[model samples]
Target: MIKHLRGVWISCLLILGVGPSAGWAGVDSDISSSRYPSIQAALDANPGKVVEVAPGIHEIHDTIRIVTAGGGLVGSGRIIQMDPARPIVRIDHASGATLRGLTLTRPEGRRETESEAVIATDTHDLALVDLRVIDNQTRGAAIELRNCVDGQIRNCLVQNYQRVAVDDRTATPDQGFAFRCIIGTGILIRECQGTLIQGNRVREDRLVATPEVKRQHGLGQIIKKNAVRGRIASQRDWDRGETDNWMQGTAIHVGSPETTDNTQVIGNLVERAGQGFDIHADHVILSQNIVNDALVGMKAMHGSKHVIVTGNQFIKNTLWSIGMMPGASSLPSRAAQGGQPARAANVDGGSIIANNIITDFGLGQTRWIWGEENVGCPIRFDHGQVPENPPLVDVIIQGNLVYDTGRDTLIKEGKPEVVPPRYRYAVLVESGPSAPVGLHFSNNLFHPGVRGISNIELKP
Candidate 1:
């Protein structure tokens, strides 16, 4: 099946005239760069043809929607400026649509809400490869792939995003200077099967810019006089200069149990995202990814089954490294709200968490996260949230190194919050009257020390 899919992908690329790229002749005829002024014009003139963009900035006013089989809109050294109202590239119900080597960006503007940079819904054999999405300001996710089949987003770089912070700890608009903090996911794969998201990197903490980035979309303004709180604030000082606190979105968000059943997220680097990978899918394999600096490392909600989280280095996350809870559509804030309910009632089948190194949790965070009903905990098995069903049938937590900084374990002792409900624990199981079934906690190394004292047993 894998070989057949690869063969299909290669045949689609060849049919789109991707290979023999220099000479540029495929099954379909090629269009010259000068034939159409804008990228959309080229795509419109030749459907199912390979449209190559020149090495310059393409200011897109509207969404360039495409429906073509065995065709692509390719770019190299191309910076496509996105209109906030619309996605720069929209492929709808098309098969074999490829978008590669394009940089899509939307600078901070007067408009508060922005849509996705690229949206492909109901597409098959779609590949978004080696694309760099920089500094998008979106109310929605950056990349929205819905009901897509046999598609993959590989070797892509989605970085340096700071939208208007929804829940800023400090430096509000009333504070004189506006703050644009990091939010939103890199890609939202909703009900998409045969999808592989691999070798992608998503980050938000970027202050310095390369010459190429500055020349592309004026990213230099973020570090200068117009620097938002996220741009100028020090690592420890979230509100020092002009800080905004937003921890709501994920780097990669996978949704649905029926459509997202066979998806695999492998070898990705997710940092400083809202949630590294907010997963609600089943038969999902999340492996070999470095997940760090997020509110939560990886969240497996109520509906997820046959999920495997292994070989991942989860570091510096604030609340919980890996949280297994009932379905809430979104993360909670201090004001008392919860995510939407999960589609599936219970978490059945075998879920594996093995060989992961989770350390330095709740360190370098902007604010104290009220975890597991306002207590500081590293790993959460939340049975209290979803009272309707028995939470887990088989949960294997083995061969992992879990560590906690002093404050994360003992929140009341180490830097207690100004607010109420100060509590602490490292491993938390919120079952209330009903304890969890099929729980396994063994062969794990716990390190909690001040310098000489081994507080491993002391660690909760």
Candidate 2:
């Protein structure tokens, strides 16, 4: 294994640009340190060649912009961001650009930023492959793609990408609750069509929400100013608390402005996350993923439609395993600017949640942080944020399984102790004016929780 890994490292080094050693003596590169003083200088001189970064630590204070067509970067090198205000790399309108085999990170104090380590905007056929994004902590996403078409992020590892962020919802009257500090995301995709996120692993190593860690970071504090001035929305039953651990952040967050479509999130693993997959797009296919030790397994909401969630596993989740709901963006006003079809209509449902498995319910790392009244349901469907929006409609939940092993395997360094699963029901569906219409459940296998199976009928 060590030999194989060493060989891989060497191969990646060669791909990125190795030194003029005996083994790499005859290889020719488009641009290298021997040929150019710096990467920017090489790109400035040759705007269309791939900047071959040498296999070592390269620190930069300003963003490396890639704007020309066919301009790209490749190397198994480490690029450290020295300035907190600037991104490590930014690709704008660089069609057919490629960034691969790179390690992007920031130094100790330089980890915090509002910008991403890598941001791609208005790019088509952009490929980010075999990349390692580590410890680039931020209130924003570690890797963000905006308005890009036909992009793919594959075989990437994003570790410790979250920083504490203040989520202020004071401006919205419907979302009166706010968090003083919340975690940030790993990968964020917005308005990107035909994007494929595959074979990636997103995890948290250090910013765990242990009791002491929460106090040390001043997290989970109540925003009294926002709470007092604005009335908390009636649907926000989960926000009733003095202080939570601020376990809020998605491992992969896709879409929000209600323009992104045709996304596929497949074959990914998200461990120790606040939320595994937060989907807010249209025509999404979420399949063959594993979410372990998270607060939530996944959720599809906010005008999302035709989402197919299948063949996934959710383990050791403290909160609900799967959630589907509507948001403020799902209002009918989103379908039109002045009573005409302007963009894709804002609507929810016509989605299928099937063939998923949920195990070890309420056994997450932060399981102790939540109370029985609020957390732990294997499947949940909720209502819209505003009354004017259409209710979640025409959904099918089938062939899913939820089983409790009555033990917590997440507790390391000890014998697995027998603990009853902490959950209300196998499935929880809200009922009201905003209740989902034409809901169907069939062929599901579930172990009864505190409240047995579900509250609503499941026939047809």
Winner by TM-score: 2
Worst 10 residues of 2 by lDDT: 19-28
- Candidate 2 at residue 23, lDDT? 28
Off by over 4 Å in 1: 1-30, 77-79, 108-112, 165-183, 206-246, 328-349, 367-375, 404-424, 433-435, 448-460
For each candidate, the alpha-carbon lDDT, in order, equals 0.65, 0.82
What CA RMSD would you report for each candidate? Answer: 11.4, 5.3
- Candidate 1 local accuracy as lDDT? 0.65
lDDT of 1 by residue, 24-108 (tens): 2222235544578777778778888767767676676777777887667665645455456667778897798887777888645
- Give the Å error, residue 248, model 1: 1.0
Error of 2 at 54 (Å): 0.9
Q: If scored against the real structure, what TM-score would every candidate get?
A: 0.71, 0.88
Model 2, TM vs. native: 0.88
lDDT per residue as tens, model 2, 234-315 = 4333355445647887899997637898999999999999999999988999999999999889988888999999999999
Give the clashing pairs for model 1.
229-242, 229-243, 328-339, 328-340, 329-339, 329-340, 330-339
Q: Candidate 1, 381: how far from true, in Å?
A: 1.1
